[model samples]
Target: MSSDRTLLMRPSPAARESLSALTPILHRVVERIGETNDITTLALEPLEPPSMNFRCGQFNMLSALGVGEIAISMSSAPHERMLRHSIRDVGAVSHALCQSSVGDLVGVRGPFGSDWRVESARGDVDQRDTVVVAGGIGLAPLRGAVEELVRDTQRGGGRIFILVGAREPSQIVFRADLESWKARGAKVSLTVDLATSEWDGRVGLVTTLLADAGFDATNSRAMLCGPEVMMRFTARALIDLGMDPEGILVSLERNMQCGVGWCGHCQLGPLLLCRDGPVVPYAGLVSQLLTQRER
Candidate 1:
């Protein structure tokens, strides 16, 4: 354990090179599965795997050779060999990337930005209980974290409660995974903004579920990912429930042109969302998060 901590304190040269943003490696699409009307999950096999590893909330910039490039978060956990991305087709780059067949090559430029801090949260003896709040496709980035928590729960590491919300029942991704996590002793709650006749579950905004999530706000860590508005409101709600502002983390989305900090496209205040964040604590982010760009 001491050696591991020492290694973390001083990353090797190869590890640093693996995290370089300027280079883009060629990754082949091994499989593509549709998640919803607009979302698709793509499995990419890298030509040469990087020496460095990625955390749960980190993202990669994927480029369709002829089209364009866009940022997508990995839905798979770090221990997983294949890089999995759950992307919603909101533009040309994302659509083109998702349209690839079994053996198409694409450019992968990252594993960038901050993480959900699940390790730090779980490692803290006082903060063993975790609260995960996600909405819509925002669940993509949080999925890896949730899986880790589930594994931890099985080993008696900590208790995790997942609260997810989507537009409707059909829009919920990883439904089976949620059930599996629940069966494994993790508490999972889901809600939708609108429901069909086939649905008999809760129907409302995700924040409403917080009242019954069964987590101790004062002693727990909360990680949120979703539309900016939803994250903002959810953070506020957690604060009201006595969660420390520093204990509340939120992932932000922006126009990230370059995977590195060179591009000013994703800058918010003095921090570049591509480099300094994507995942940031709520403690000192009031001004930047409340800014117009966040909305």
Candidate 2:
């Protein structure tokens, strides 16, 4: 679909205004999925009915009253309404999310962007092989994608290889959850740049570890999210490994001030980063990215 036509799918004005209000939801921190290098995972209970539903790989704009707001992906899938966030404590607002008490207040404003193609994968059988590659905080968004394929009762042909990496062993998000998934027979592989005494897993850049993991990619769908550099590199790897540009889906992050596209900070070429996408197919936006900055 064309870019302008794509933005037409965005929510109406009244909905956007309500999102701007930053409705408070008194959700509790039910579980800490993982915490490393100052990033924390929080689980919340909804105080009111959410106006929007989130899918795996979608995100929300969260804020702290006196501090600021940042874009965070929905760690929880639509079926699992339990809101989860993996916040890196690099700034004041993120730090607040880290230090917040179990029964704290959080301003939840989305369920935004395109969701992982779970329902489609559930119905599609043989071509259902999916691979999810993540780096840094990128693992958070794609977690739901993994959950869907692994937990989908109807999807038998679906197989997932979750390859995740971080700066070091201590900074890896969802460590315990990933471990549990692996224990439950989910095909998950983890890596880190800096090895630690406690670490017995692979040690290398995320892309390097891909050398050890192999998959039949003839008709597979691959989803990746993480730092822009990592996503670019991984996209190339998937292409080299036989995945088509159309089959490779990526989540694109830009400086977003408004959930609606009216704010121009998140613009990527003719596309609105806020409305048209946080997710873009390689076939559509590859050339635009190639013409720009290296990082």
Candidate 3:
């Protein structure tokens, strides 16, 4: 095993052209919700509507030119195109994005991506089952789907359960929304990798939380978004609990350039992650793809 540490820095690639429906977003930070460590929620908006729209779970690559571009998921729905990016100040672009003050100008690109199958879940709710597993900012993708499920009645079949795990309680995203969800009777279970005094929540990995949540794996479909390690383990756990492999949706993150898949930047072996899937069935990934890091 390599002992080298992973470095956090901005990618050097030039920014690609933003889609026709997108534009430079000039807005203000109406609110800032800091959780801990440098992860914070920024409620920023554009002075005007984005030329384009995106499905839930799609992401935009935001850039500050020399600062670099980072893919951030849109936490808001289509109607509220006003963008909300939950940023962790980990690298140059991210740090720049987070350091900006109210009313700063930023560039936004296509709601580029292979969107999560939130649409498929529609009208599928009666006696339907749904499960979401997220780690750290992994929760970003799931948040949109959860909101869709909670509000969209066409999907009246399934009961929704969210199992989220973070490094520590402070690293958790959507803290206020979590309480609001609970108050509104949504089922959410949380855990953490490391404990801090501020944490009174469950202590353990997300897999453990999944095991105890008592989901009917046979009928429930699961969406897992997290680091590769967590997503892999979570998929195995779900299968062991009797969920069908085909029923689980996973987002494979790779370096994405042409979000449309032509550039091949986000290819996963034979599959192009940006086009074929950022969301895909676990069964579809080739064994070699699952086992190796991309060259």
Candidate 4:
């Protein structure tokens, strides 16, 4: 394949081993908060937190010793010493990681991939609005960006609009955080794919919520994460609403065996989701890559 087709140049074997990508560092689990039957939020204290600086949408290769390793996104705000991972029990490695108890040591190998551009979203809020759209577990990667925006809003910055959707009300993650943001001046809306009789909230596709999200599309920058199909439609909706394609960002999910570009598992056209991005401008992506299976 053409070198231009890859996100970055592949490092030599020696370089790969010497880099942090292959060297696993031991981190102790400080807490494990369960979100649902299959999802757990884990907080880990690494041996050296400062050395592990990461931005939103980045991932870590977490290894449960004998079980195996998996690529999981960091769910905490930037610069936090206590790194967090919101994981779902979908496979052996994930199940093992979620089952880990407090004080247990797990191998961590990254703070990998590109960022969600929280800083840019915070800049010139008077001229533009930051719109965040997340669905189901997609909220995991978005949690940090939301926190960043919340902090900015608290500092007298502009308001943000967050739209979240889940299969049902029960599947919604970070309910408390969402409410807290809303109370602090963030425009937050919720919807569910299938609503129970008890649910008085909006019930339908997430796109339906856009009709009333009240964001200025021409002056808005959107960050999105969710099921591929959902993101596809969401991007289309955003475009139809007059947002620039370059201003719409999406985080992609892929089979990332290596948290670096060594493995081709996470390649998405001219980019590697591991290195070039898990978060990318919607304008740069091709349809085939975005529709592939989730991580």
Best by lDDT: 4
Candidate with maximal TM-score: 1
lDDT score for candidate 3 against the true structure: 0.71
Cα lDDT for residue 89, model 4?
95
lDDT tens per residue, model 4, 32-98:
9999778899998865443467787889999886789898999998766578999999999999999
Q: Could you give candidate 2's per-residue lDDT for residues 80-167 as a string of tens digits?
A: 7577887888778888777777766566667567666666744554446777888978888887777776775245656677889888
**lDDT values for all models:** 0.82, 0.71, 0.71, 0.83
User: Which runs in model 2 stand beyond 4 Å of their true positions?
Assistant: 1-34, 50-52, 121-126, 290-295
**What is residue 249's positional error in candidate 3, in angstroms?**
0.7
TM-scores for all candidates: the values are: 0.89, 0.84, 0.84, 0.88
Number of backbone clashes in candidate 1: 0
lDDT of 3 by residue, 95-202 (tens): 888887665656666667666676664534445577889998888767777777666434464677888899887788888777766665568999998989877889
Candidate 1 Cα outliers beyond 4 Å, as residue runs = 1-20, 49-52, 121-127
Comparing 1 with 4 on lDDT, the higher-scoring candidate is 4
Better of 2 and 4 by TM-score: 4
Candidate 1 lDDT for residue 94: 86
Candidate 1: TM-score? 0.89
- TM-score, candidate 4, is 0.88
The weakest ten consecutive residues by lDDT in model 3 span 1-10
